[model samples]
Target: MDLIEVLQHRYTAKAYNPDRRLPEEIVAQLMAALRFSPSSVNAQPWHFIVAGDEAGKARVAKGAAGPFAYNAPKILNASHVVLLCARTTLPPEHLQAVLDQEQADGRFAGEEAREGQRKTRAGYVALHEQAGDLGMWTQKQAYIALGFLLLAAGTLGVDATPMEGFDAEALDGAFGLTDKGLAPAVIVALGYHSDADFNAKLPKSRLADSVVFSRA
Candidate 1:
C-alpha cells in the first residue's frame, strides 16, 4: 500500500493472533527501520529489547502487572514485543562511538568534516545536559524510533500496538536495564490481529486539519 493508504488502514491492534507468527525477514526490516531512526545530534541514546520467545515475552509481560494488567495479554499474545529504552545519560564515549562509525562508514569527507561533526554533536549534547532533563530528552528520541517502527510495520502489513502503560521501573528491574544504563520508555507489540479484535473494525478518528494544523 502507499504511505497514505497504509496510514489509513493501520490501527492499534488490541489483540493478536497467537497462531500467526511474524516471519524473520519482516522482523529484520522493522529492526532496520528502527536502527536508521533519526535522533537529535545523532546521539542515538537508546536500546531496544526484542522479546520473541515465550519466556522472554512472559518476562516482559510481568512488567504490566497490577495497574497495567491490561497490557500483559497483548504483550504475551503478540508474535514479538519490543521494549524501547532510553539511556539515562548520553556520555561522551557514546558520541565518540557514533563519530567513529561515521568515519568508518565514509560519512565524513575528510578529517575537517569529522571534527566538525564531533563539535556540533557535542554542542547539542551539552545544550541538552544544561537543560537538566537529558534522560527525558533521550526518551523523546526513542519515541521517534517508535514512530518509525509503527509506520514500517504498517507498510509491512504487520499489526502493532504502541503501549506506554507498563511499569517502567519494574520493567527496568526485570530486564536489568538500569545496570545497562537504560530505562524503559514504551513497548510495541507486533503480529497479526486476532479475529476478535474489535479495534480492527473501528473507524479511524482524528481532528480536522484546520484544527490540527495552521499556515502562518
Candidate 2:
C-alpha cells in the first residue's frame, strides 16, 4: 500500500492476537528503522529495549501495572513490546563517541570536516544544556524514533500501539535504566490485532487541514 493508504488505515491496536508472531525479517526491518531515525544534530539520544518472549514481555509489563493496568494486557499479549528510552544526560564523551562513529562511517572528508561536524553538534547540545532543557530535548528525539517505528510497522503490515500510559519511574527501575543514564520515554506494542480490538473497526479521525494548516 502507498504511504497515504497506510496512514489512513493504521490505527492504535488496543488488543493483539497472542498466537501470532511477526516474521523475523520484519522485526529486523523495524529495528533498522529505529536505528536510522532522524534527530536534531543526529544526536541519536535513545536506546530501545525490545521484548519478544514471554519472560521479557512480563518484565516490560511492570510499568503497566497499578493505575496503568488498562495497558498491561496490550504489552503482555503482543508479539513484542519495545521500551523506548531517552538518554538522561548528554556528556561530552557521548558527543565524541558520535563524532568518532561518523568519521568511521566516512561522513567526513578529513580532519577539518570532522572537527567542524563536532563543533556544530556540540553547539546545539550546549545550547539545550544551557537552557536547562537537555533532558526534554533528548526525549523529543526518542519520540521521533517512535514515530518512525510506528510508520515502518504499518508499511510492513504489522499493527502497532505507541503508548505513554506506563509509569516511567517503574520501568526505569525495572530495566536499571537510570544507572545507565537512560530513562523510559514510551512503550510500543507490536503484533496483529485480536478480534477484541474495537479500534480496528473505527474510521480514522483527524482535524480538517484548514484548522491545522495555514499559508505563511
Candidate 3:
C-alpha cells in the first residue's frame, strides 16, 4: 500500500475478532522498527512483558477493564499481547557505556562532565529528581518507544489501541514486574480488524494549520 495511504487510514480498533493472530516474525519486525526509535543518550528504558497465554492475558484484561476490558477475548485470540513495561532504573551497563563514550569523545570533558553531573543533581535536589542522570533520559526514552510502536503497527496493517487508562501499580503486580523494577506506562491492544473496528468512523483531530508554526 502507498505510505501515506497506510497512515491516512490508521485507527484504533475498539472491538476485535477473538480468532485473529499475528505471526511471530511479524512481531519481531515490529520490534525491529522499535530499534530505530530515538532516545536520549540512547538509553532505551523500555522492557516488554510478552503476555500471550490465557491466564496472563486474562490477568491484564481484568486489570485494565474500563472501555477496553470487554474485548479481552479478542486480544487473547491474538498470538500474543505485549505489556510495555519501562524499567524505572537506567540499565547500568548502558549508562556506563554512554558516559564512557562521552568521556572519550571529550564532549563533556572531565570538568564539564563534572559540571553536568552537578547540574543534574541540582535538578533533583532543587526540584526533586531521582537516580540522577538517568531520571531525565529515561523519561525521554519511553516516549520515543511509544511513537515507534504506533508507527510500526501501522506499517504492518495491524490495528492497535494505545492506552493509559488503567492503574500502573496494579498492572505491574499482575505482570509480576515489581521484582523486575519496571513500571507499566501504556497498554496497547493489537490485532487484525473485524471491519466494524476499522477507522471509518474516526476523524483525526488537529490544531488548525494556522494555529501551528515554526519559531524560525
Q: After superposition, how far is residue 154 of candidate 2 from its true place, in Å?
A: 0.8
lDDT of 1 by residue, 1-216 (tens): 689999999999999988899999999999998999999888899999999989999989988999999999899999999999999987878888999999999899889999999999999888888999888899999999999999999999999999999987789778999988998999899999999899999999999989989998
lDDT (10s digit) by residue, model 2, range 1-216: 899999998889999999999999999999999999999999889999999999999999999988999999999999998999999888889998999899889999899999898999999988998999989999999999999999999999999998899887788778999899998889999999999999999999999999999999
Q: List the global CA lDDT of all models.
A: 0.93, 0.93, 0.65
Q: Give the residue spans of candidate 3 off by over 4 A.
A: 66-79, 91-137
lDDT of 1: 0.93
Error of 2 at 161 (Å): 0.6
Where model 2 places Cα greater than 4 Å from the true spot, the runs are none
Per-candidate TM-scores read 0.98, 0.98, 0.72
Q: In model 1, which runs have C-alpha deviations exceeding 4 angstroms?
A: none
Candidate 2 at 50: error in angstroms? 0.6
Model 2: ten consecutive residues of lowest lDDT = 165-174
How many steric overlaps does candidate 3 have? 1
* Pairs that collide, model 3: 124-129
